[model samples]
Target: MIRASNVVYSYLKYGRTGEEPVSVRALDHVDLEIERGSFISIIGHNGSGKSTLAKHFNGLLFPKEGTVWIDDLPTDGKGNLAQIRQKVCMVFQNPDNQIIGATVEEDIAFGLENMQVPTEQMQERIDRSLEAVGLTEKRNENPGCLSGGQKQKTAIAGAVAVSPQCLVLDEATAMLDPRARREVIRVARKLNEEEGITVILITHFMDEIIHSHRIFVMDHGVVVQSGTPKEIFADPGLLEQYHLELPPVTKLAFGLRQKGLPLELPVLEPEELLKQLLRIRKGGGAC
Candidate 1:
């Protein structure tokens, strides 16, 4: 659904007049492809350039040296800009920054209004979008009155109201508590599973990546590792080198393995760990 070829982007810091501008490279010759209808998570420490890559997916930032193509349309062209944005939408970290309208339904309809969606169909889309995010009851409520999780859901409803084919979430759960984070993630999973929207989620939390179909690990503005969550978590040395933590269950399994207990290499979830323990007991290998 999306492809980047040798893409490089730099930001110029302006100096006083007659002085040379300083250029800071944000993305350096990065190449990536996101399959249609797949859930992909990107993880990296701070300043790894993962967020920069997400912006390119929605034409928020065009590459200076290379090219970005969305559904076979070049992103840099003026004529293709609208189509590219329509195909991919972005949800940022702060709900306050994204929410605009006075009421929940109005905020959800903001995107469709910008797209010039017909007034007759706008109400239908707004209603359905609010329903999809489970915010229908709050349609007339002011967004500020909602909780953090509800605000995030409102942001998501706004994005989905346009019926975009892809969703890019850049640290969308960073500021929320654990409960709110899980709520946002559940909404994201539902969108991908039920709505068939391709999802590219960028986050620093290891637990969030456990359910992803695939993961891409970034380091110093480059993709150092890319694999399924199981493969990536199984290698402790690699995770340490990348400054990443293993999922809680995986860490427990690793600790058991260190004590001479035969355990699976990557126990991604609690249920998987429980099943492995049951098999071990049945095979007379119980610790």
Candidate 2:
């Protein structure tokens, strides 16, 4: 489990004012608890602190005030930094920045090597990680030769090769094309569903939140609302306030509702919306 209690972080910047410091509060009195083996999505506008909060989960930045604990280990303590990082792994937006090894298998082995896994076990781990990401055949290939999606998958393989308890993706798909983005998301879903690894997905895309167990919406460094996708999508006004767009299907359902159609509050996917429309057309009971 991960917990943040009244966490606060500030950045000090220097201007041409004779060494004066300016502080910008990236996170402000934020509190949250993420359960084990659950998939959660964090969404917000630009500069809304979603990424800032993500950094805290991996101990990349300690809270200036209050506390952040990962599985009972305080992230602020210098002694626990290594342990905290090992438990929670992070993937960034750019695949280029994350890739280090020349080949896919070598990249997956990089993390395990740092932990000093035996040479005999390294090959097995490398093989397993590559298979997990559906890139076993590309193990011998260079990361530069793969497509954007493949590169991200390789990055994910590297992260999972370490066997972390929790995976924090900070807009991991932002740089990929639509097809590539879908591929990365599918891999993330498989990790959470098949491996039972907790997933913390930080993204601005509304479609990505549909599969999440819970959604947390942030604005101006504060958590404004959080709930299941159904509850969060029910209020179009709230989403507009945060400058967020609804999933395409949800928006279509909302438009139907405004036209005197008896549609449900939240229509997460196109299939769900289609089913609801069919039921309504057949004069079925309450949708």
Candidate 3:
């Protein structure tokens, strides 16, 4: 499990003379707990401290005031840094930045080699992770030769090959097209459900978060609210206050309901909205 208590981080500012040199609080008394083998999502607009919080989970930045623990191991860089990193892996928004090997298969095995795994075991891990990410056919291709989605899959395969207990995706799908974004989300879901890996998905895409067990909404530097998608979507007023917007399908359904249609007020999924529209049409609520 990952636990954070009263976590605080500040960034120093530098300017011309007599500026007072203020500090910006990127995370203000942030507190959260994530269980092992659970799937979760964190949503916020740009500059909402989503990335700052994600950095803490992996020990990239230590809290200035509080403690962050990964299953009782503190992220204070005393002696648990390497061990914590081994247990928790991070994938970034850009796939190219994470690539380390000349070939796809070699890239997957890079971490295993760094961990000094035996040659035979490394091959097994590479094969398994490639298949897991649906990149087995691209095993021998050049890393730069694949599409954007494929490159991201290759990056994920590399992380999976290491077999970390948890994977924190920091906007892993932001750079992909619609189809590629869906593809990445499907892989993340498969890893969470089939492999039972703890998945921490940080994204701005509301549709991508519908299947998460819980959603944490962050604004400015604090977590304003957290709940399941249903609970969060039900309060459109609260979301709008944070400069956040719902998925397009939810907006459409809510608009129709306001116009005297029988659509659900917070229809989160397109399928749910479709069902309500069908019911309204059959009941002669629409002209």
Clashes of 1: 0
Model 1, 163-259: lDDT tens per residue?
A: 9999998999998999999999999999999999999999988888899988999887788888999889979899899888998889999998788
The TM-scores of all predictions, comma-separated, are 0.95, 0.96, 0.95
Which regions of candidate 2 are displaced past 4 Å?
A: 17-19, 284-287
What is the C-alpha lDDT profile of model 2 across 211-234, one tens digit per residue?
Answer: 999999999999989999999998
lDDT of 3 by residue, 1-287 (tens): 99989999998888898787889999999999998998999998888899899899879999999999999899997889888888889999999899978899988888888888899899889998999889999999999888889999999998898898899999999999999999999999999999988999999898999899999999988999999888988878988988888888888888888888876678888888888888888888873
lDDT of 2: 0.90
- The lDDT, on a scale of 0 to 1, for candidate 1 is 0.90
The order of the candidates by TM-score, greatest first, is 2, 1, 3
lDDT of each: 0.90, 0.90, 0.90
Backbone clashes, candidate 3: 0
Record all residue pairs in model 1 with backbone atoms less than 3 Å apart, i.e. clashing: none
Candidate 1's C-alpha runs over 4 A off are: 14-19
